[model samples]
Target: MSKRGNRLRNQGKRGSRRAAAARDGNDNGSGKRGARSGERSRIGRFVRRVIVLGVAVVLLAAIFLAFAVGFAARSIPSYYQLQASAVGQTILVRARDGSEIVELGPSFGEWLDYEEIPDTMVDAMVAVEDRRFRSHFGIDFWRTGGAILEGMTGSRERVGGTSTITQQLARNLFLSSNRTFDRKAREAVLAMALEWRFSKEQILELYLNKVYFGGGAYGIDSASRKFFSHPATDLSVAEAAIIAGLVKAPSRYSPTADVQAAVDRAQVVLRLMREQGYITAREANVDVDTVELKQQSGQNSVRYFTDWALPQLDILLPETSAPIEVWTTLDVGMQRAASAAIESNTPANAQGALVSLDRDGAVLALVGGTDYVETNFNRATAAMRQPGSSWKLFVYLAALEAGYTPDDRVVDTPVTIDGWSPRNSSGRNVGETNLRTAFAYSINTVAAQLGNEVGFGTVASMARRFGVSSPISTFPSMVLGSSEVRLIEMTEAFAAVSAGGMAVEPYGILKVETAAGENLYRHEAARETQLVPDYVAAGITDLLQAAVQTGTGRAANIGRPVAGKTGTTSSNKDGWFVGFSSGITTGVWMGRDDAAAVPGLQGGRAPAQAFAAYMRYAVKDRPVEEFDTDLDLPEWRLEPDDEALFGDPDEYYYIDEDGNLIEPGRRDPMDDSFDVEGERPGGREGNRNGSGEPPPAVSEDFLERATGGPVRAPDPPAVPPRQRPRETLDVPPAPSANRQRDGGSGQDQLIY
Candidate 1:
């Protein structure tokens, strides 16, 4: 203020002198006008200079404040260093069987220290991300100027960036996402502070380990692990470069999420490496397609199974990075077979489940749903649906336990119970038939009647023992297999019988290991004895074998000795087939995601075909022998009928000493001698129980009148028959009926 006052006084004196001079020159009008104009111009120029100085001072203070805030933010701890007390972003670790599956970073992005990363990995990363990184403190001003200059004349994206890894990490970790001048200044300030606080190695390490590489992978370790199923240090040149280039935009360079973009970005990185003299041009320009990533890396399709196995994993292994080896029983062959069987054979509109288990509860192959890629729906253990006639297997077991025999007859007539009248799917009568025929045909009427006779409580108790979670009803409908059951339950129950009647729970995930290869835990199959007499299971098995050979499961017959039963919900809504050849037990289920009906669908059609297809590989090179007929079985024969036991009754006088009509209370007359087939088990020597398809169908249908070539190669057999308890076809299932059914549409097994 004092200086301004002195200047003003001087200016006033000068102006007065000028005024006196102007008065003398009053006669000269031009001179007076010139003096006035000059004084006005000087005053305006002084004010403009004052404004310019004030604006410059304000901008300097703002820049300082921006730098100060960025410096403070740079003090936060990194992802690897953060503790519960640390004021840093969250980092959640996920492990399976004590081995890290993946680690998720906080919204701020993930970070790791230099010591935690491999030097090779760091080198590879630098070579691809920022070849000039070491020469620059945090950012490369010269390169950035070039980038900006190039971008001014070209598209921004096409021009790319020259930010060193450290600067990029600073921008990602401690600054705004904005790109305006103010934001750039803040980013620059943070970059400088990061350089001042951390060594160059430290900065680059954080950049390499914190950046996302898409496919939900965070950090170079995770990105490498996610894309190649290998550790960062193990990365090949191409693989390392591919991950390195992901820093620009993870989604664009993700091998799984965007393969084309990833390849393109990888090429750019290779070119940059050559231009920057990191590698020879010829070395850098290798074909990326020739690179082989770790198998099953980006396609972690086993997520569902891995998730379900986690809870059990905790009890077996409560922590990560242990030294105990846990071997899983998963057979990759079986897993792939199950997946392929479902994907290739299931009707387009339908979703399905496939589970393969050993007699001792070991899960050989398990596919929870049609597409793990589309949805992680674990149909094997999570989904529940009515077992349909498949539930009859348990009913039959209960009947056998209650002293019923294969020859025992049950009525096929409609019956009512608790306001429900259960009828056969076709609503037709097949007259009196033996249990073998009844089960083979999947007769709903007979099954319901038998369920009533066995006592609903007895059937329910048996099913529960076999590992069913849903409640079973005490009604006639229970016989027709109307209770909701999971694929695991059916698989376990059927596996029990195959295992001589012992329950085997399906399980996956052998063990998980740390980055250093330290084993944490392993899985053990849980076995529980669920059946009393092994013979009872074998009896059911004998009948089931016939089903695949000649009954509804004919499609399931791969010209080999296969034992399985087919089940179809009314109207082709659900189809199921559970089969076993000695040790391998596979269960298949097909149903629409929206629960739509498929035309001509039966358990034997697509489900059986799929089972057979998978079985071919699931048991490849394995023994193909069945349980010997003489193993721990009871000495029993087909029971005689009422006509033989009661000497033929003449009226509805209800004579057999029981109130029941179709079922008799008096046991049928026993056959003093065993039936020829049951007595001489060695007769099966002629059966096709070996390792391949039976001699191409010598049946009249498959062969032409002369040439044995299939009379029109059978359409790759669809799964499960078009229906359970299929009607005695007015005509055989041929190509003509097949095309018509596809056009007609329904849950009846149309391929579409």
Candidate 2:
């Protein structure tokens, strides 16, 4: 191609080559211009792309901020609920004398306004908890940035020191103390919400009022009272510092647990306050010895009483968020006496419960157990125990209501009802005697016969009428107090008797008042309804008086007129004594919680002694008053008759060395003449005389007639004396001369 120009007619085109050079110059210039234009176009396209990317990034950031705000708003609670959380109120239970028994629910001190809080307290709180609390809206961006930086660089597992005062308040009011990402997000949102709805001062007030202090105290007010025995208005600078320090670790810095540790923590708070200009340097130097602490009273025995009465408030008043003051019917004095008596008299291996009621059915004193601290099970109001022979009160009451008086004649021989044979405690029949005598002697056979005479259903009904709310089956054993019942119910039943047939529902609470002194509940006067006819009650009272005056209940005597019943369960598992005197009724019970038998346990022993001891203090101030025995009924004076009167009228009853009833002409078994046939006596034929016709064989229907039920067959061969079970009558005592006149030697001794 070079040659093309070479040969191009070398010589011939000298003029043509000059023209081509001009054209080439023009084309080259145009090409350079085009290249420059393409470069400028590429630069413009890159600028446009960069502008679009910037716009998209800004939009994404705005969307993220919107989503975060919406999520936080959704987790916020209503304003009313937030305010309600601040009024955590507790109930204060007071005795009849207005002395504090116990406080139920979380310990809460009196409510106070923001202005009521001491300035030093507020300043110390702000200095130690959050120095920049006043400046931040809800979150501290500066602190948050520091926390994030530290978390990334430091060895800490998680970010911390990010929560401001507002944030802490939000957590206390609405959020849990869970260190989770979601929780932190919610807490931040709630803090912002609080800041929006409440002012700075209002937020501070809520925080101070809702925060927890150590030792079961809540709020600054409670802390003040619990630590200093004064109101929040009287908070000293040192005290304020000590309380403020507790917000970090309450139990570790509790003034009650360790005063030195609390004071050391408070020193840190004081230094922080000084650094923040909240206090002067001189003011920050608080003397540790000046921090006088007043701890709450140690756990009290009266806690048992309050625990029992706490549930009753729900029935007595409407639910409320305000504080309550419960005025109970408990007599502080009686309660102490009852506690002492039970503690002194209760066996070491056994527990005791006591209940005392006024004629109006007001519970004056109740001891659920010997030591409430060991166990809090309320035996008086909750334990279900077999009432034992005390149940005979209902059986005899049914009989008396069935037109049978105390003077009604009854036999005290071994009796069987529905295959259940019961013998006198003495293991020997007293033969024939009036109902009064039989009851005073605690004759189990007479009680069984009386229960059969008045249907078991009737006996149960009588018990229910007397205030035994426990379920009572119609089984014949119920007549002997086999049913389980609460001690409160039994005592209430006796209170009804003391009230002259008026039905009684025992009550412990008298009134409930609000912290503002408004009446939330006031017990209305109980309506008096007839549970039993007055005559029947009087007749029952007669039997009870006779029992206490000269019978098994003699141990319960308080040197005054008293009426009561004694009950000893089988195997000595339970012993009970319930009595009334000076218009006050009380019941005492002793037993093991496992129902384990206590050797030598009897109603006439420990139970009776406790009842007497308590009653002595209970009625010490009341005037001595006798029971109204004027029922205008027929006289029941005893007189020697031709049947089996072998001694003086007053000496017809006989008792052996063990204070158990013995048959006439049965002298001391150790005497040589005790078994002499026909020895100066008018004994029945074949009855220890060994001289007349043998006793007739028992008829097939005899057991059925005696038990008020059908008998499958005649009695089996007589059981050997040693093989048959003996129910020795657990009687207290009687005069010894009565037995001496019959045949026993003159020696008074009581079998435990």
Candidate 3:
């Protein structure tokens, strides 16, 4: 205010102002101190909370570790128990002559002490699998942390594998292969248990002796013998490296699966070994070419037979864990021949299976697939494909039993039953012919008529009596071979015919015994009861022989008294040839697994060719046998009698170029133009003479007369192979609305 009221009065004013200024400065300093004090208090509270949280997290982790350890301790088995069950008893399967067929089940070669395992192998496994195996007690904390981090960030190459040898050993010995949280926890706990219970060398020994090495080899000893045909003691560095490399993925890196891949994997293992200072650089530089695998027969197909026979052994010796020897009925030579036939004749993108049975129903040979390594499905006994016209065996047998002869007259004209129409492969149906002619020709209409007349129940009974184990459909289409059946059963049925009407159960194992030579089970040869009358068998054999001589099955003729049938399904989905020659009944099937059509496949082509090829070799050593059953036979006729059927001289039949009987002089342009060798025109020349060409096409006018309406043959719809819905699907699959394309039958006639 008043500028200090002048100098004199200013003395008093100045004194007051200085006092106020000093008080103000003191107040400002106190406020700053209060703010600093509050900040220190807040920091102290934050520090205390952080300390409590850290303690809580540590406590929870401790609790979890303790619980995991307790659970693992309770579940872990004794080391001795693990060793005993690690590899089951080895199953030694021998052929009929007592020659070794294969060693199946858990095949452990020989147990070796920890010192016996090669140090190079131990080092390679440890270096590639775990870097700090000796330093880590059980879990490598550094790698585990990295694995966790990678998993959380979704960057782990694969999540949840403990990158340590001990963990892998724990999994191999006592854990399932599921990658769940519980499994991971148990794996970690068991890993720690293993590390604590056994020394590193002991753990390594167990790992080497328990790990799978593919090709059914378990343990290092077994793997060495399987891959190198040598004992583990003799495994070279390269061989050891290859065997050790299989620890990661036995199937993917099997020497038999891909030798180059195995060598490459072994090279990686060697480099890891050298990097970890387990071997010198020179020792790790072995040439891949030097790693020669044991020479094995190209026919690994025997594995299929062994795989099939192994299960049967259990039936003979139930629940017994002792090592047993299974003497099978397998003829090694015939098995090889069957494998060669299948490998040579199976079409690309298609699979083939064959089953051969001796007169006593002993399985002579079985070819499950063209390449057993590619697929071990055992289609001969497992695949349920439609038997096509091959199913007519049951229908014809039923007819023969019902007082009908192969020479009896049958009609093949276009006919419908209960809204189902089955067309012949050649589209045109011969009007009237004997059962033998229809049988030889594989006429669908005639077979369907016989199945209906004999009653579907009776036909099914005949199939059952012949050892057809699968469900038989009673649908109208079933008469046309719509029911699915196993190839083995079909072969067994044919074997029954070959055995002169005895019921036969297809058997592979002749005897079972302990490895110590104690008899466990021996097949007692009993006289088989007759399932079909002698006349019926004789009639079926006559029909079958005629079929091979001059019918769809002409390609299967082996120059002897061979009796067989050719079968093809709609859309060419399946091709089958089942026959008997020289007391051996063999059935062959060719088809795609997905039931997709193969454009040109036919039963008379590849299937019959394969049959003929195998049979020629199969019967070469055996005496030529005739199918004379000492039963009365009827006269065999090839052509239908139009004069007897219609009493019309104008409708006299004339033989066309492709083996069809046409009216008078009507001819197709496609006739006489077949490019097959040994073909003769103007008569039954193509399929009838084994030319493998389909019958001549039917005219549109003939189709109109057959169906009472103009018919167009459209592409057949794809029908999935049927499986039994309940225990069995006796109801037939819905027949296609349009005419079915010729199954593999070679004839162009629609089947269903």
Candidate 4:
């Protein structure tokens, strides 16, 4: 082949090979490009499917959130509706002359509007409870987020709560305080609703008006009045802070519960107020010492009287919601006197009670315990204790009604009946004595012999007739006051004797009326029924006068013609003195609530002293009048011979050379050994030297000489003193016997 031909052929073959190579390279390149494009398409499709799925999930979440928010919003209540509900009213108890004594019912004190509340109080509440109250719409998202972050971080310090003032108001007014998520969601929704319905000031005003402060105070005004004795508008910055801080826990921060805790909480509130720019640091600096917190009044002062009178309200105005005024017969002066008497007389660990009544049975004064705030036990009317020697009044009255005279002869020697032996309080029995001498000396043996002769049933009936409502046992011990009786009932019975034998029922509430002055009930003076003959009552009065003048009740004398009896029970568990003046009958009792024996306590000591102290004030302005006595009885007949009655006349009575009694149980002023300023053996007014101590034995001749007459022999065999069948008599003693003695035996003997 020619070179050109060979070159062309080679070139053709080479060009064909190159073209084939190019074609192969193009095929390979196109295949590689197609494979890359297929992979890119697959990746783009996957990305597109993922983006669509994410968008769908977001849309579903948005729809669910909208549904939940809508449900929560629907649960909100109308704020205006809640404001229209009725609130409870306070009940007022007033003195007889219209002075306010105490308040009853659910909420105490009056309610006030928002304008009446101080601005400091509002600022304090906002700063301490919700710092972002003004900026938030019921709930603060920023605060909520911070709290959530804090919880997630496990921070120790409490993260600020997210509830705004409006939120708190909503919860307080319309929602339950449940801590469930559902309740929280409802609270948030209700807060928003409240914000939408009311302005910021209106919402705050509602919150202040409805928030509970401690001490039964429901609103700011009530709380201010209860704690400071003033209106809410008059609250100082410190006071406002103190009250505002109570919202967290009223009882826990109550000043009455712990003043220091309340003060500490106030300090926190003040610090917050300063931090929030509500107050300056200087203004926030409060001296807790200068805070004059008002002491609790009404409830603490007259709890006993009010407790007793409260039960009567149900009967006065039963099932009624209206406020009422109860008029009580309590005399503030006498009540103060009684309270002072008990406080000054009783030991710190001991309890005492006093009840004073007018002749008509009007309860003038009543002291149940030392401090009513410490305890509400009404010891005066509720406590039932043995009367001890005070019970002898009935026994003597029964004997007198059984035709026994005060001059009748009775043996003071030990006597036995039904396996029971009775001895004189002196331990040594007086051989023979007249009834008057035995009665004056409080001889147990003589009293027992007389009680046996008259019968226990007779004494029990006499006590009932004299106004003793408690059960009276038909036992010989009843004559010695073994039966229990209430102080009030005993006082009433004594008042009956003072009222010339007329039965008197003690009453405190004089009238009950509505707040509008319409009378619900008015006390009418009940006609007194004669419980005993006037002569009989006068006789007992005479005897009791002698008792005070020379016997166990000498300590209770008020420098007037007073009649009373001293009673000291077994183990000194109870010490009592029930006395009566012309106008008042008062009973004083000192003892332990647990019935534990009070050391060194005797009826003639503290009890009689307290009685004298109280009566001196109780009868201050009243005219002193002498107790009525039976005119038929001889004036000096009841006076026993001191030498005959008490073994040593010098020990019991001071007699002049003329043989006339000078001072009973005391040294005569004329005696050279008598030191006027020196402490006497029986120092108290009503107490005698041997008042509660064992008596000394007297010779039989001394007894005859003391009686001012010869001792008559025992009645003949026609009626054996012990064998004579006793008859029960319900009448009190005759005036002759009652007026002749004021007698009670020693600690060892039970004599009245």
lDDT of each: 0.65, 0.77, 0.79, 0.74
**In candidate 2, what are the lDDT values of residues 403-434, reduced to their tens digit?**
56676556566655667787667779877677
Better of 2 and 3 by TM-score: 3
Across 1-752, the per-residue lDDT of candidate 4 in tens digits comes to 78899889888998899999999999999999999999999999999999999999999976875565566556554556655533455678777666887787656345456676678989988888888888887788887888888889998565235677777777777677788899887787777766666778888878887777777777788888878888888989999988998988888898877899999989988988998899998998878657889986534446687777768767766577677778898887778888888989986589999999988888888888888866678999898888888778887777665545555555566566555676555689766566666666667766676677666777788988888889889766667788889998888888988988888888888888787888888888998598876656776777777778888778898888898888888888999888899679999999998989999888888999999999999888889898777534332223233222233444455445445565546654544331223333445322233343323233346546765556543323322121111223333222111212223331111131
A best-first ranking of the candidates according to their TM-score comes to 3, 4, 2, 1
87-144 per-residue lDDT for model 3 (tens digits): 5577788999999978777778788788898776777678777878888978899998
418 in model 3: Cα distance from truth in Å?
A: 5.3
Give a tens-digit lDDT track for model 1, residues 369-410.
776655677888788777777788888887666555565444
Winner of 2 and 4 under TM-score: 4
lDDT head-to-head 2 vs 4, winner: 2
TM-score head-to-head 3 vs 4, winner: 3
* Candidate 2: stretches off by over 4 Å: 1-87, 108-216, 219-298, 633-752
RMSD to true structure for each model, in Å: 21.5, 18.4, 17.2, 22.0
Query: How far in Å is the alpha carbon of 100 misplaced in model 3?
Result: 2.8
> Looking at model 2, how many pairs of residues clash?
3
For model 1, how big is the CA root-mean-square deviation? 21.5
**Model 3, total clashes:** 4
Clashing pairs in 3: 425-749, 426-749, 427-749, 569-743
